[model samples]
Each structure stands twice: as structure tokens, then as C-alpha cells.
Target: MMASNIELEQFYSREVEFPSPLLASHIKTAEREVHTLLAGMRSILRKNIDPSIEELIVQTGSSYEGLKVKGKMELDFMIVLFHPKFIFIPVTSDYSGYCKIKFQQEQLQSEMQSSKKWTSSSPPHSFQYDFTSDGYLIPSEIYKWFQSLADKAVNQNKSKFVRKFVGNLPARTLILNISPGVDICVDLVPAICIDRDLYVVAKPLKTSPDPHLWRLSLSVFEKKILSQHQSSCHLKALKILKYLREHDTRLEETSQFASGICSYHLKTASLHQLAQRPDTPEGLLEHLHQLMDFLIECMQRRELNHFFIGNPSSLAEKAKVPSNITHGERCLNLFDDKFVKESTLNQARERLVKIKGSLPAIIQQHSGPVAYSCNIY
Candidate 1:
């Protein structure tokens, strides 16, 4: 799961030709058309049911980690559904979005093949909420219509129709096999919005054995392993942790205490000579352990990263220990005094589980502290 700098470069090197704005605009118009159709369907269904059922809230689901099934990949659904859940395809706006998205998929597939480009991109079924201006679903009184849609599908015993009209139940995830030959899995589940409606959303559903841990863990681990080399990656880890501490203040300060210390450890470790003990498994393990401890500290402080670390200088000073300096030794006695503070406005993001009732199953405690640390020196 580690991406080398070369691999990362290759991943982004390809010419990703998105459709022109005119083409996308037409598609946007078509999307609005589809939304209109969906709204119409919900409206009709509402007329058939009693008038007392209340409003529906629609939201989409996103994948934070990769999903795997039978050792293959799949597409994650950016779910669009109504709130105040119903059985099966509980969300109301899904009925129309489903059909329209399916249609877009087929069209995109045809276009891709016609151009002779063997790309891994899925058909156009996946879309963000920005496709149409003023097009995002609102919390509206459309429950009666959704109930009627469910009833119609069930009364006829039409599973395909039910699956299509009612759609899949709200799920915590929609796994897509964008890598060819893998089947796609869509989840129909209710969504939980975190923070304001702007950024960092999570959907917690019943998941598999593997948890898609955040990419930040890998960064932390890599910085630790490369502690023997003088690399900017070490400073990168420290800055990231510092930014997280400065902007996020929703968790305990002790949670990020380790992260701050690990940043200092990485800074000191990276200053050492590379291949000081060359080609030895024992040396590698030492480096690996160093990295693990750093990552462990970050995980422990994962929740704290959501809150600001008060007395940043005090925490930094406490964490500022030298790598080779033994316990009880004064490490920074000879170094020039430097105070690292926010150079620009902080742009830190909040990382929290977006489950309705509790934190995500992929909580901090269960993440692997033993991942291979890339030598990004």
C-alpha cells in the first residue's frame, strides 16, 4: 500500500482529459433533467400516500479508504438519498439519481471505448454534488412519495424494479472496482454530516476485516523509519502535526503530545548519516521500531489532532529530544534557538468519524503500527 515517489509520479503523469466545459455543461443540463425526473417521480409517489408523512433529507456517501472484495477493487458510491430513513432504498431522491447515473455510465463507457484509450476510470455514474447549480437535495416533505414508491415496487414483487425504483439501502460505503475486472458494490445507507456542510465527512457502516486507515499514518511511519537520514520528510511530519494541533482543538491535548515528540524525534533522527550500519536486518528493525513508536504516538493523538494544542511551545520543548541522546541527557543544549510558528493562515482539516451515533469502526486503536516505512530521503 506504500507509494514510492516514482509510483506517485506515475499515477499522476497520465493525461487525464476531462470533458470540455461545453460537454460537461450539456451533461450538467442532462443531470438537471435527471434530477427533475427524480423529483417528479417522488412527487407522484407522494400523491398516492397519506399527506402526513414529513420531510426527506438527502445526502451522499464518500470512501475515505480503499475497499477490497475477493481480492479485487470496486467503485465507491457517492450516495444521494433522502433522510428520516425508509426500508430498502430509504432515501427518496435516489430513485431518479439511480437511473440517470446509470444512463451516464453507459454513455461514458461508449465514449471511452470509442477513443481507444484503455483507462481505468469508471463510467460517469459517480458524480459530486456540484453537477447542477441549486440542484443539491434539501430536507423536504417528500416521505409520503418515497413510501409509495416502496409500496409499488413491493406490491408487484419486482426485485429489479424495486432495486431500481426503491434503490439500494443507505450504506456506509459504496465500493467500486475502478480497476478493470472487479465488480462494483453500491451501498444504500443513511449519511451523517460532520462539522458544517463543507468538508471532512464520514459514513460508518458494517465494514469488512480491513479498515482503510488514513494516509497520514503512512506519512508518520515513513518519517520515523527515515530517522537516520537528513531528509525534509522528517520536517514535513512535524509541520503536519503542528498544523493539526494549531487548527484542531476538539480532542485532549495529551493525545497530540506524542505526535509532537515524534516530530522532534524524526527531525533529530533524519540528521544522522545514511547507511551508518549498512545492509543489516538488525539495523533495519531498529529504524522500523523507531518509526512504529512515532506512528503509535500519532494514532494515540489521532483524536487530539481534531483540536488545537494549547501552549504549543511548551509541548514542542517537551518533545524536543535528540535521537542519540540517552534518556536523562540534555539534547538541545548546543543548538541555536528557533521558534517554529504558523507562517501563514492555518489550513488544517478535521479528521473524525461521520457515523450517526458513534465513532467509525476504523477507530485509531486498531490501525497497524507496523506498516513498511518508505525511505523518502
Candidate 2:
């Protein structure tokens, strides 16, 4: 039998909003397991390639980000290496930094085919690579080094959590099979820590994309923002947004990846809506409505501006802008460059265009109205 609106609302609260304590404990345990393996891996990297890559940043997971379902969690952890050798003193120019990055590009060729998505076509024309001391590496170098470590770990059974090879690309991947049946997989991504204090992040754009450079990934900052959000409504709204997205298949066949729309896009929309509306119980229903409405507008416009991140070059401000030709002519809009690539976005347009019209009925049916208070308050 189908659950009524009240039951559905209760289910969301009991399931997503307040996930079981046992499930929460499991997430924490899984994270601890992932961290233990990464610690060993980091030790290996330090002993082999460079001694400075000491820590891996837990980029996203239920334990930290509050963006996880009860049973499932996606661990997007990143290995950050500090520039091999460096000491910095304040400089008179726009910034202060020391150490030049000498990139190792030889090994990247092997996995270039696998990493074609992140691999860039052309190199950034000009920019001072002085922050090598700040965890940064040539895409290929990071991939090759980590690949060796992961392979060795698996072959030697170095870590108890060692999983078989899930992907060939070394940087953006390396899923660990901590358990059987792939019940728990941790994604180890190699990222250049552009600015740790700011949580400014960039990924290796190897080839098959625009250029070989550091693409912005401000998800950490977004996670931080959501952490400090005034209400848990934002999280609730995000959960529902994801549920609706997965359940609604208006354009199922058009997804570039698993689902046409992604969690990042959904989270981005939810955050934006929360900024305007309060993230309270009374505000959640309207929040979902506004969130979907915003997504529809973005699809109709054929552009979805990244709320937290922007072009990496002009990252001095609160939001970055596209660099001028002098700085590599990076894409000003992150949506255009990263999140939903042109091809994927184009494929999703048909589905997106129809979403607003279909969302109301879907919400009315799936998301019960019992929890919402429509009054202006």
C-alpha cells in the first residue's frame, strides 16, 4: 500500500532528517576505516615520492557534510601534498610565495585515455607556479604515483581495507573496497591544495577538456557554509531534492552520467534557496518549491552559475571571475566549465524544461503537505 502524505512526511523526518543513530555510528566507523587506510597510503607516498604529502582531506561524506542517505555514503576524499620544498616570506606583489613546481608528465600518458574527461587540450598560457610547496602536482605525476601505491597496497594486501582496482585513472579515482559487494567504497582523489586556509581547491585538468590546469573545486567551502547554516532545513531540502531527482525520470536516457542531474547541482540549488528562505521546518516545503523553481530557471537559461565557486584565476574575491587572456582565459562560470558539461547540460535540457511543470504534482504526491505551513511566516 502507498503511504499517505502524512506518512511520507513522517518517513522523511524519521529517515532522512534524523537518520538513525546506528546508521550514524556506522558512517563514523566507515570514515575511521577509510582514514586508517589513507594514513598508511600517505605514509607510503611520503616514503616513496615526496615526504610532504602527509594528509588526505575528507572532502565530502555524511559524517562531515550531512549529505548522506541512511544506508549509503559517498566518500570523496583527496590526498593533498605540500610543495616538496618551500619557505615563504611576504612579497610586494599580489601574493607571497616561493618554490617553483617542476611537473612530471611522463606517466600520465598511460591513464590519459581513462582521464580524458579531466585531461585538458591546451596548457594554461601563463601563470607563476610558485606554490609547489603548497600541495600541488602535475596531474600525471599525482596519478602515476598514487596508482603505484594503490596497486602495491592491493597486491601486497598492505591495508586491510584495500580494495581491487575500480578505476584506471589515478587522481580522480582509486576506489577502496573496504568491504565485500562494494558495500563501502572510498574515492581517493588527488587535489592541488591551492589555498588551504581558504579551503581553495583545484583538480588536475589533464586532457580531453579545455586545458591542463587546476580547475576550481570549492565544495569544501560550500560544505563549510552549510555547516554554519542557520537551519537544518537546507539539509532536509537537499535530501528531498535528491529524492525527487532520482525518482523523477522525465529525461532518464539523457544523463551524461548515472542520473541526468547530480548531487552537486542539487546541493547548489538547495543552498541558494536557503540563503533567501529560512531553513526551518515551516520553511522547508517552500524551500523545496523555490529550489526546484530555481533549477528550472537555470535549465531554461542554459546556464547554472556555481553558487560557491567561480573561475580559479580571479579567486582573490569572494567569488572568482574568468581570467583575462593573460591568465589562460578560464571559464568564468563553473557550470560552463565543470559541473554539468555542455554536452550533458544539452542532453538534460529537455528534462529540465519539463521539471517545473511536473514538480508540483510530484511534490504533492510524494512530499506530504502536513509538515508545511504556507503562511508568510
Model 2 quality (TM-score): 0.65
Error of 1 at 42 (Å): 2.4
TM-score per prediction, in order, is 0.24, 0.65
lDDT (tens digit, per residue) of candidate 1 on 1-377: 23233432222122111123422342333234333333444454432122221233232211111001011111222213323222121111211111101111124346545754344574322121112112222111122233344345344442211122223222222222222332233332222222122111122112222121100001122223344332333332233233223322324343333223323333333223121332334332244333334434433333212110111222222334222122222222111112111211111112311111122231222222221111111
Q: Which residue pairs in candidate 2 have backbone atoms (N, alpha carbon, C) closer than 3 angstroms, thus clashing?
A: 81-135, 83-132, 83-133, 118-206, 119-206, 119-207, 120-206, 120-207
Query: Highest TM-score: which candidate?
Result: 2
Candidate 1 Cα RMSD (Å)? 22.5
**Model 1 misplaced stretches (Cα beyond 4 Å):** 1-44, 48-181, 191-294, 300-377
RMSD of each: 22.5, 11.0
Scored by lDDT, the top model is 2
Query: In candidate 2, what are the lDDT values of residues 15-106, reduced to their tens digit?
Result: 45534584455456556765665665655554323535555564664445776654334456766656534222211121111112344333
